[model samples]
Target chain A: QQQVKQSPQSLIVQKGGISIINCAYENTAFDYFPWYQQFPGKGPALLIAIRPDVSEKKEGRFTISFNKSAKQFSLHIMDSQPGDSATYFCAASHRSNDYKLSFGAGTTVTVRA
Target chain B: GAGVSQSPSNKVTEKGKDVELRCDPISGHTALYWYRQSLGQGLEFLIYFQGNSAPDKSGLPSDRFSAERTGGSVSTLTIQRTQQEDSAVYLCASTLWGGEAFFGQGTRLTVV
Candidate 1:
């Protein structure tokens, strides 16, 4: 079963605008939620993450808004740039468990110039 | 290698042949993980090893897939009797205990 589900398999946003990607999880035991950004022919890189203890986390231009009760989280890019065009994956893991991350189907984001 | 390193970035193997992929974790990183990326599907967890603990193989797709970690640093994934459906990019990641993981350029495996 897919533990995590992401919406908008692909997204296109204008430069200098906001870009958002949303994800939901079925496993309530997950405590850590992280987003990864991947470019073509490259590995996924950690973008932003949030714990169940916080409702929102902001890291510069990247922000993760997590709703613990809803088991949903979203990534928002402020002032999206062409350079930010890439694939984004949302993942979840439990800190005390095997630490294996369950990932979403991934969203391909395009920032139009 | 300064980062997580994977050997044989691309491998083209015949169906029914056996193949082995290798991964070298970052220095001082105690946690190592393997994941597979396929078309449309996202990263699928394959296995994980943390320090000296027993490895987790629950995510393995079938009995044909196996992995082992030696000296708590390097790992090898072996597939027996390759199939075309096995084609995918295998990714390796490592991290300090409870820290964010760093990934390596994946090994693209194509079975013909």
Candidate 2:
């Protein structure tokens, strides 16, 4: 079963605009949510993460908005740039148990300059 | 010395052949993981190794797939009698305790 689901298989955003990607999960036990960015020929790197206790977390230009009741979370990139073009994945996991991550299918983002 | 490292960036093999992929986790990291990425697909969990704890093989797709971590540092994934559907990019990641994971470049395996 796909525990986590994401939308918009691909996204195109203009430079300096906002880029958004959304994800939802079915497992209520998941308490940690993280977003990863991956460029071609490279592994996915952690961009930002949020816990269920917080409503939102921001790091530099990247923000993660999480809704605990709804079991959903999203990543928003402010002032998008061409260098931000890459594939993004959302993942969820529980801390008490094994740290195996359940990932969304992924979204390919293109920031056009 | 600083990040997770994987060997054999690319491998092409005939069907029914066995293939082995290696991963070297960062120094002092206690958690290691393996994931698979198919074309246009998300990272699929394969296995995980924590300090001394039993490895979690629940995510493994089939019995033909197996993994082993030696000395709590390096890991090896072995695939027996590979099939075309097994072709994908294999990624390795390492983390300290329960912190964020660091990923390696990955190894692209193609089975004909």
Candidate 3:
């Protein structure tokens, strides 16, 4: 029930296109959802995050479309660039609990030039 | 360092030897967490500590793995009798409240 399943183990997209990664969870107690971007030989960095109170949150070129009822959320990258090429991970955690994040099997994205 | 810092960025030890990994979270952050990441895999929660509260060690893999946080600051993860299966990257993260977390570069342990 703690699992967050992510789709498209790997993705290849052209520049100027949209890159979308989807994730689903089973635990309904999760209130905070965050996406992380990680490069080789580096730890995951917090990219963008959202709460169940809002359905969608956008920051610059990154957008987090959340579906509380469906128990799913997605990260959408507009105008995907080569610099954005990296592994993305979706994570969820309950605010009231210990704050331990449950992450999904990462999705490796490759933006073609 | 301004961010979470881990020691011995790379450690290659012999099997059956004991190894200790360190984590120095961002100053003033009360919440700290430890995770393990294998190649091409997701982060595996190992433990969590919040201030002086009792740590949540439910995610620890075995008896050989243990950790301790001193004075609500630096933390050390001790792996006793390490095996080759323990070869992986150990990551540490910290957060101020209940929001996003900041991660360190991580310690890559290669048990040969």
Which lDDT tens digits does candidate 2 get at residues A1-113?
Answer: 88899988999999999999999998998988999999999999999988898999999999999988889899999999999999999999998767688899999999999
lDDT of 2 by residue, B26-82 (tens): 999999999999999999999999999999998899999999999999999999999
TM-score of chain A of each: 0.97, 0.97, 0.97
Q: What is the TM-score of chain B in candidate 1?
A: 0.98
lDDT by residue (A20-74, candidate 1, tens digit) is 9999998889988999999988889999889999899999999999998888999
C-alpha TM-score for every candidate: 0.97, 0.98, 0.98
Q: Which stretches of candidate 1 lie over 4 Å from their true place?
A: none
What is the DockQ for all candidates, taken in turn?
A: 0.86, 0.90, 0.84
Candidates sorted by TM-score, descending order? 2, 3, 1
Put down candidate 3 lDDT per residue, A1-113, tens digits, no spaces. Answer: 43899988999999999999999999999989999999999999999999999999999999999998899999999999999999999999997667799999899999999
Can you give the lDDT of residue A19 in candidate 2?
Answer: 92
Q: Looking at every candidate separately, what fraction of the true A–B Cα contacts under 8 Å does it contain?
A: 0.85, 0.90, 0.78
Between 1 and 2, whose DockQ is larger? Answer: 2
lDDT of each: 0.93, 0.94, 0.94
In the predicted model 2, the residue pairs found to clash are: none
Q: What is the lDDT of residue A77 in candidate 2?
A: 94
